[model samples]
Target chain A: MEDLTAVAVHTDVSLWGLFWQAGFIVKLVMVGLLGASIWTWGIILDKSLGFGRAKRAFDRFEQVFWSGQSLEELYRNLGDKRTTGMGAIFIAAMREWKKSFEKGARSPIALQMRIDKAMDVALARESDYLAARLTSLATIGSAGPFIGLFGTVIGIMTSFMGIAGSKSTSLAVVAPGIAEALLATAIGLVAAIPAVIAYNKLSSDAGKLTARMEGFADEFSAILSRQIDEKLPRT
Target chain B: MRGSITSSAIIHAALLGWGLLSFSAPTPMDMANSESMPIDIVSDVSQLQKGDKKAEKNEKPAPKPTQKPQTIPDAQNVGDSETDVETKPATETKAKPVEAAEAPKPSETPVAKPDPQPEPKPEVKPEPKPTPVPATEVKPEPEPKQEVKPDPVAEAINDVKPVPAPAETPKAEPAPQAEKPAEEEFKLPEKVAMPQAKPTPPAQTAKTPDRKETPEKPKTQTASTPSKEKDGIADQVADLLNKQKASAGGAKRSTDQASLGASKTTGGSSLSQSEMDALRGIIEGNWNKPVGAEESPDMKIIVRFRLTQDGQIDGSPEVSGTGADAGLLNAVKSSALRAVMRSAPFNLPQDKYDTWSTVELTFYPGAT
Candidate 1:
């Protein structure tokens, strides 16, 4: 920053200086790019943190389920509060299985079908949560450079107009405008690159998390079906 | 969502601060001017200054030594002859400074005659006597003094109090050329029959300061008649003469304009063409070109003026125009001058103060 300011002192070519001097259209492009970059980074952080939390929750929920605790007791432990991830799938299947007993239902086939349907709906909801905003990341990553190019085009066009008005094709006249223009493209790329990389990494993490939830749902449903057969003896 | 936004803001601030701390903008180092040939206008202008200087020098030596072909064998035996040396070279060289080699022989004798006018003019012309600057200043300081342009230069030299007893007589000649044989008008004719024994004028600078001040008018009128427009500086020399006519003594104006041309020879560089044209346009907007005033003496006027940091005129500017002897040309010169004057305190870029602090503007009045 010391050197940055030193250069500015000698010649006013600082970033802020460029922004201030830029034409209205270029300024608009720069501001828009800035917003996109911030939004991209926000999405990246959210998805990364959310995926990590989901994985940790799934691990804890699986450990509790396999700890030989009674299903009813575990379901009670969920306290009827809104559950998440693998736990939501477990709660949904358990409630369905409990409802069969309360209604004095006799057909194991119908009760089993209802429990599986409940788990499937919960799984789909979790999947939707994991996949949210991923499309926006893809859009920004693909479109960032083109937005930057638009700013550059506007900047260069304005610089040419300056040249015509000045009546001299000297490099000094054109350089500042071009530099200001290029900064827009540079910002666009800066915003885009991280968004693209984060999107790839987080999407993979989310998929792994979903796969774990699906596996847990299958194992819990299998346990319930086995318990039902033993309790009634299928007689 | 809130957490992510806060995280993004923190990350961005950190990134920007770090980038700012580490990044440095690269500055351009000094570079060469791309292939256009650079003109050393000072040398070019000075080289052209020699012709007008020649005609001016011829008049100074004529009033004294009114001898014509007298058989004074004794004076002939005295190999130290002022006439035999100063006259031939004055006419022979025209304006070529090559004969500056012979300029040394008369250094002692020409010292007195050359002292009055050319002395102040050199300091004033910003090296006005381009009569081989090195040779003239080196051989006889007075040789450069020999080119004192305006007749008022004679009075200014008399004012500087260095060389004059007979220099004053030459000063006297300018004011009443009739009283002194109209030497300026007939200076060419006189140069042919010239006996150059004018050493008597150098000693009287102290005696007739009053007599010299009295004679300035006619001398300026006569000075205007003989001035030849050579290069851009020629107009300045004429302007210096005319300025002398206005000021009663051209000496003060010359010294004020010279100021060592210090501002220019420093880190100052020429303004880009656009800058030059803009400056010219601003001045030209105020300039009213004379009708049919489109020739060498009238078409061009150059004014070299100093500017303060705030872009106000620093002092009275030095102005020169060609063929100032004619009334129309004189009007053209003054009108061009009035344009520069009327356009007060110029608006130049501030960051380029070093380059524009002192500007020498060559104005083409009738050009597109």
Candidate 2:
């Protein structure tokens, strides 16, 4: 009777116990979820850092862009090496402008168009870089739960099998399996929740940053166009 | 960027430490929950005996017919021998020699042969001698002292036979103790007619009382002879028996009620334990722990709620706690609440309303 009571009493199923006791498929599911969760956290960390750095660098570059220095001198000071997000776009547009002047393309419209095209291309490339690996976050968020559920289902199935084999419907018999199974879903959610939230938050931040770059590109092209208008004879 | 990452790492490390700490902390609730009741074997045995005696007395009068065939003949033979000796003693000379020779054998047989074969002869003879001796020596003081001496001898013999016999004839022993001497006189015929109607022994020494009653009554009543003494001793013995029966019955009844009360309380309490476990199992079973919840083991939600008598959740469980990220905390809390809500109407005992009416359960996923 004491043994039975003990069996009945100490029915608390520990998490490690659950995982260790889980079947092959469930264990695989749990491992997969854990991997996904870890990867998601890594992505979150990397993206947040990258976005913060890009935003700060953009702020610094904007300060220098508007420092009222000669555009030629500023471009020269940037050197041949593309330094930052905004600098790279500025360099691409200026380099195309300088080339047009060297080639003696006296047509102001054509010069303005070339500079805009170069800056647009640069903006697209920078946007791509900012948006990189964001899809992984979305994927983890959406798929993590399902993977966890799959593990849970397997764990529960194992528990039912145990119940059938043991021929007793006692909680002690079934609690461990059920707890383990739930751990899978839990891990999945753990992996998925942050990934989902991070994806939403970071994607929007990235989008806003990309928009600012496009705005800068458009503004830079306008300045070049204004310069060409003043330098070329009236068409 | 480095500072933020370091902070995040520190936070994760702290969470990991907390989880480890919480995991290692032993839950005291498990010890509180598994309680055992101690059973008293001695009290139980005594109560059982009392119950047995009460039952025997209550059902005694009804089963007289079954015992009639076995005990009636012995009683009749006893009466006939008593009468022969009593009536012949009046014809002094002729009866004296025969009575003297016969008297010593009866007295000696009881003292010498403690066996069942000589029981009938000794029992019959002892009754007549004690009656006549007590009547002749009317000084009640000497008579009782003399009676007390032989009474123990008779009791010692009866004690051996009575153990098994009382089980079969509990009613006979006590009735014979009260009325055996008086019935040997004019009431002999009636005693024979209702020979099976012996009352149960009030005490352990039922046969000794019978032997004692025969001598005591004859000495007490030389005037009215059988009538007054018969009523006096018979009523006294009867009253004593009734009082004993009443007291035993009362004790047995009270103990019965106590046991019933004990069982009811234990039964209710035990039922609640299982009900609580069932509730715990269902909720825990449904809980899908959020990933990384183990990292923040301190993130616990205390869910308090009331349950109706019929086991239905009376109100929504209120979740209150703070730890981890909002998204993570909310996910864990909602999942915990959802599990409880999903497994609605817990299997609570209706009779034990006070125990489970309100519950405050702590949901710490990995710890549980």
Top candidate on lDDT is: 2
lDDT by residue for model 1 over B1-368, one digit each (tens)? 98888878888878877765555354676566342211111111111111222223331112122224433223222232343332234333333233233344334333544555564344444422322222222222333234334345454554343433334556544323222432232232233123233322321222132232223322433343343222234445434442211113221111111122232222234566676667766777887877766544334566777788888888887877664447766787687678778877778666566567667766654444
Docking class of 1: acceptable
Tens digit of lDDT per residue, candidate 1, span A111-148?
Answer: 77898999999999998899899889988898999999
Q: What is the C-alpha lDDT of each candidate?
A: 0.63, 0.64
Each candidate: how many clashes? 21, 8
- Provide TM-scores for the models: 0.45, 0.47
DockQ of each: 0.36, 0.10
Q: Using DockQ as the measure, which candidate wins?
A: 1
Score chain A of each prediction against the true chain A by TM-score and list the results.
Answer: 0.90, 0.91
Candidate 1 segments exceeding 4 Å error: A1-11, A233-235, B17-25, B30-368
lDDT of 2 by residue, B148-188 (tens): 66565566565454444446445454435434533244333
